[model samples]
Target: MTLKVERLGHSTRLQEVSFAAQPGELVGILGANGAGKSTLLQLLCGVLEPDAGQLTYQQRDLTQISAYERRQLLGYLPQTPVAEGGIRVDHFLQAGLVNLHLSCPGKELNRVVETLQIHALLERTLDKLSGGEQRRVHIARALLGDHNWLLCDEPTTSLDLYYQLQVMAVLRAQADRGKLVTLALHDLGLAARYCDRLVLIDKGRLLAEGAPAAVLTDANLAQAYKIKARWLCTDEGVTLLPSLLS
Candidate 1:
């Protein structure tokens, strides 16, 4: 699945921004606060409609499709996910899969739960889990159905170092399996490590889009973020090493 956004616009913020992502690609959107990253994700998820331009999925206009059909092909994780009802974690996940009409049985559910390391909290109420834990459950639910596209906003927020890497690892695995995963990330280092592509936006406008190493250069960081940062590449991955701003 590939996505094309041309001249996409919101009411007050983003304007005429465009980008594209191919299948099995992990595209990370990097920007400072209020960069319209969340808005872009919401638009792509069909939660909000663009006033102008075209959103195409596989060369088909998304606005022409039914809301239900558009949702069935996309999975979205917002910046802040609020869990509803007094449902237990496992029950919520089950309901999510049911709503998507996925064919996953008990075994698959167990595997996903275990992979996220949330098996122990399955029986717990959603409200009982920590913020990070709840975020993990939300991720598991978003990934429950076999959706082709994932639009995640700030996926690593509230997660500790361990779980942060873990979440990125899971996202990378999803991309490897031919899913188009787009994430709005604050952590540039993590983005470089896991994301196959990067889209940089500033003040509701697209600044750059390409490989992390190229798009996340010292000059680009300074230009978009107004902060001096050094770029280092190793066999492991690219690193955004920053010095004290003067």
Candidate 2:
């Protein structure tokens, strides 16, 4: 069964936002700062209890599910992931397995390390790594298990463009391999190119939800961001030019 949200609300941060995502689709949550993208993701991963509405996945009602069951169903990466600065990368990743109660730590660890290309950094401590490297490790931790549903808040934030595309590509590949991956991303270009569908949130409400070309239109940009922007469209995909922001 697909992941479904019906009239979901959380205080004033989010209100009556509803959407559905299926396995094999990468969904991007697009919104301005404080537009409830992060809040919506929290409800998806059970970080916050909804003050209203329903959340269900795989024929199970997530709103009423046990913590253990929720753990089994969702894997999450917070907007600002934290770890002991002194902890070694290996141990840090291993801890995620322990926390999530995952099996075959060695196998799982190797898989994520390989996918994220972080094998060489395994012996380094968290404080020693650069921002991009730390973000990669955090993503690896969130991806420890074979979760069908994954939620991440701004997985590409604060990284250089290279890392941004790398991380988004990894998540997109995961979705192609049959996982419902959702992430809140500020980069419209990344979201347009990598996400199978987009949910445009504005002022804690759903402004639009559809294909990239449909959601990232001139009208939506003006309404959601209050800016005049340009889209460079090509055979490959759409790319939003920040220079055109006015």
Candidate 3:
């Protein structure tokens, strides 16, 4: 089944943005700050309603689904860490599965903890961890469920380069395993390297949508980010290295 947004719009933010993504694809949403990336994610997850268009999954109207069903379909990770209390990480992760009423909560916890490499942080209190560590914990919790779509907003924000790559890899692996993974990223290099497809939104409109190589062009970079960027081709994929605006 494919998830699609048709003519998605919000009066002040987005304007007739349209796109579609299917399972097993890592889709990246890229744009300048306040370019409606977060708003787009929120609309997809039903956190905000589009005043002008529709969100559909496999031809079913998403706006008509119940809250519980919507929860089962989408897992969202906000840009800021939402769990800041002093709860133990293990308990926190377990609560995520429990809230979903999973039949095998323990199994889910083990899967996420191992996949995210957060075994060491499992026993620590949430508030005691650094910002990056907390981000890892949140990511693990978000991954605890078997949701079809994972919408992440800047999941790599506070991480060092190592952890940033680590998190991105886990997300990519999720896409490989037949889940639709979409994330908002500021790192053009990472977005181009890890994402299978890119949705470049410039000033609240979709400027381009296609493979990373097709979307991250020099003109797109200058128009969206106001910078002259060079695309470096590598064996892995293309990477955008931005230089000063001409």
The CA lDDT of each predicted structure is: 0.85, 0.87, 0.87
Give model 1 RMSD, 1 decimal.
1.7
Poorest 10 consecutive residues of model 1 by lDDT?
A: 96-105
List, in order, the clash count of every candidate structure.
0, 0, 0
Tell me which of candidates 1 and 2 scores higher on lDDT. Answer: 2
lDDT tens readout by residue for model 1, 1-246: 578989899986688889888999999988989888898888888878888889998988987888778668888888888657578998888877655665655766886787788988899998888889889988887776668888899988889989998999999999999999999998899998998999998898888899987888777787778888876778977667776567
Q: Relative to the unseen true structure, what is the C-alpha lDDT of residue 187 in candidate 3, on a scale of 0 to 100?
A: 96
Q: Where is model 3 more than 4 Å wrong at Cα? A: none
Runs off by more than 4 Å, candidate 2: 99-103, 243-246
Off by over 4 Å in 1: none
Q: Write the per-residue lDDT of candidate 3 for residues 81-172, one digit (tens) a residue.
A: 56559899998887787558678778888988898899999899998999899998898888878788899999998899899989998998
What is the descending lDDT order? 3, 2, 1
What TM-score fits each model?
Answer: 0.93, 0.94, 0.95
Q: What's the CA RMSD for each of the models? A: 1.7, 1.7, 1.4
Error of 2 at 46 (Å): 1.0
Q: Model 2: what TM-score?
A: 0.94
Tens digits of lDDT, candidate 2, 153-239:
999866777878788889988898999999999989888899999999999999999898899888898888887677788997778
